[model samples]
Target: MRPAAPEDEPALDAFFGHVDAEDLRFRFLSAVRKVDHDQLKAMVTIDHDRTEHFLAFDPASGQIIATAMLAADQSFRRAEVAIAVHRDFKRMGISWTLLDHVAEFARWKGILTLESIESRDNHDAIDLERERGWIASACPGDPTSTILRMTL
Candidate 1:
């Protein structure tokens, strides 16, 4: 896996097609039918100091199989993280590895806490995060979603 760049825009667009629609909604926290050009642009063209987007590539095929993004607040004390794996790559421990990698990366960047807002129905992700010591709480005014937080 490597930090995403502007050149990765096209690849990310294609990668999303391989992700399950439900997973897409989980990643974006919305019912997104398709990713647009502007959304892809915002992802790849980020300031390295405050935001980092990572693309995980399959070693054999060299195809993008997953992505993890971390965006820090102005104080850099906390950051929101999001990740997604292609449907074919699910249940392969990709999400676990990516979460670890993102956490370590956030620590290196001086972020004190990491947060992920996941849909309440995403049991696997919530379970994995809980096992990793993340605490879950209700999303303010949004009963359909839950906020998971961890301190690095």
Candidate 2:
């Protein structure tokens, strides 16, 4: 996996296009049928300092198979992280590896905390986060969501 670049927009879009609807909803925390070009652009165009995106490639196919995003708050003390792996790539430890990568990046960026706001229905992701030592709590205003946090 490596940091995403502007040139990766098309590949990122294609990757999201092939992702399952449920996976997209888990990643975005909403019912998104499709990831628009503008949104894809925003993801790939990273500032590196505050917001960074990373993509994991299929070694054999050279296609983007997973993505991780880290967005730090204005104070640079806390950051939100999100990750998604292709349907075919699930259960291969890809998500775990990507989460570790993002956490390392967050620590290097001087972030004190890393958080993931996940839908309540995304039990697999929440479980994975818990396995990685993140604390899970119900989101205050959103009963449908859970917040997973780790202090770096």
Candidate 3:
């Protein structure tokens, strides 16, 4: 795992495209209305140029299999983490590695907390977040969505 660079955009897109549209919806629900190239770019690289993007690559192929974006708010004391892994790479410990590094980055930066909101229907994701000690909250009238937070 490493910080993403400007040159990593194409690989990032490719990795994202490996997951089906329905998978994306299941993970984010209506919170993410669409997943277009511009949206992917913005989520993966357009924020902080240096340290916010974390990627997992296969050393044998030099191909990124997963990515997590940790973008700090204006205060720089907390961040929102968004993670995505290629469908083929799911359950291979890539998300765990990415999330672990994201926590390490937050610790290094003296951040207070890391937050991730996943759809309630995305049980795998919810379970992952909960296993990491994230506090979960539900969206009113929406049983399919949840907000999770972890103190750094």
Candidate 2 C-alpha lDDT tens digits along 1-152: 89999999989988998789999999988889999988998998768889999999999999999999999999999999999888888899999999999999888889999999999999999999999999999899999999999999
Model 3 ranges off by over 4 Å: 26-35, 43-51, 140-143
For candidate 1, write residues 9-98 as lDDT tens digits: 999999999988999888898999899999999999999999999999999988899999999999999999999999999999998999
**Top-lDDT structure, candidate number:** 1
lDDT of each: 0.94, 0.92, 0.76
lDDT agreement of model 1 with the native: 0.94
Candidate 1 clash pair list: none
- Expressed as tens digits, the lDDT of each residue in 17-119 for candidate 3 is 7766766676445545446677656655565523387778889888888778788877777788878887788898887778888998888887888888777
lDDT-better candidate, 1 vs 2: 1
Residue 41 accuracy (lDDT) in model 1: 98
Candidate 2 colliding pairs: none
